[model samples]
Target: MKSRLNVVFTCFLLLPSMVFAEAQSRPRAVDDFFANREILATVYFTVGSAQLNRAGEQVLDKLVPEIEQLDPDVHLVRIEGVHPRKDHDRMTELAMLRAKTILEYLHHRLTVPVDLTLTGSSPSPEVRRAGRSQHRADIVVYDNLFDPHTADTNEALSR
Candidate 1:
């Protein structure tokens, strides 16, 4: 009876800590960028041009209200330029510009300032073969303001 009483007491002590740990605000899957990010829009650009075309603007126009609905302080934004690597230098330069252009567009449109990260990378071989899919900017949003994959989270997890 004493051993059983000790077991119940130990469980009572452990339960609250487990509940609090489960309530941690950090994203459940820290390293999963695709799982963590909310894809707001995938706007495409003309070949060699970072400028927003008619369809791009229309897509962005639809995006504005959705973004405005979120509190800028709690949400994070990122623009990823999906340019597949080519033998020439133009694609790299063009990709970064495409990401920046989308961010700039967001900066001008959002009523409140949003935390934005601009990134550009060559798409995977599969995406590279998708033709028009390469010259694109993906607008991603996250509920967490800071990056979950940052060293801060990794360090905490290690402990």
Candidate 2:
């Protein structure tokens, strides 16, 4: 009876700490970027144009209201841009322009300030073939304020 009582006491003592640790370890809500929460619009550019054509503008218009509806406490935003394997110069210029253009659109239309992140990389250093054209202009719209694949998150958490 004493041993059983001790086991119950131990579990009782540990339960709250276990619950606290689990709560802390669980991923934050902003990490739900993969689940497509905060990012409302993702615009992929053609070869050399940052100009939002009719379709792009239409997407932005729809996204603006959705973004505004999020809770005020959510302040994270991520904007990533990818480069094409061919015609590097044209795509690089367009990607950079697209990143800036996205930020501007969010600010002007959504009336919300967001922390922005930008990533630029070629589809491949050496162009292979025509099979991977869509990979050329890969852009992601996510709400994660930090890159989960990098050390930045650990460093930030430590601080």
**Which of the numbered candidates is closest to the native, going by highest TM-score?**
1
For every model in order, what is the number of clashing pairs? 0, 0
Regions of model 2 farther than 4 Å from truth: 1-39, 71-75, 86-90, 123-159
lDDT, each prediction: 0.69, 0.51
| Residue 140 displacement in candidate 2 (angstroms) | 4.7
Off by over 4 Å in 1: 1-30, 72-74, 86-88, 129-132, 143-159
Could you tell me which 10 consecutive residues in candidate 1 have the lowest summed lDDT? 12-21
Encode model 2's per-residue lDDT on 63-86: one tens digit a residue.
Answer: 776666654334445444445542
* Candidate 2, position 39, lDDT: 40
Q: What does the lDDT read for residue 139 in candidate 1?
A: 88
Q: In candidate 2, where is summed lDDT lowest over 10 consecutive residues?
A: 131-140
- Candidate 2 at 5: error in angstroms? 68
What does each candidate score in C-alpha RMSD? Answer: 17.7, 18.6
Candidate 1 CA-lDDT value: 0.69
- Per-residue lDDT of 1-159 in model 1, one digit per residue for the tens? 978954653454344334445655545444343356778899988877899998988888889888778765457777877666744446755776898788888788878666777766666555666665888999888655253454367644653
- State the lDDT at 125 in candidate 1: 59
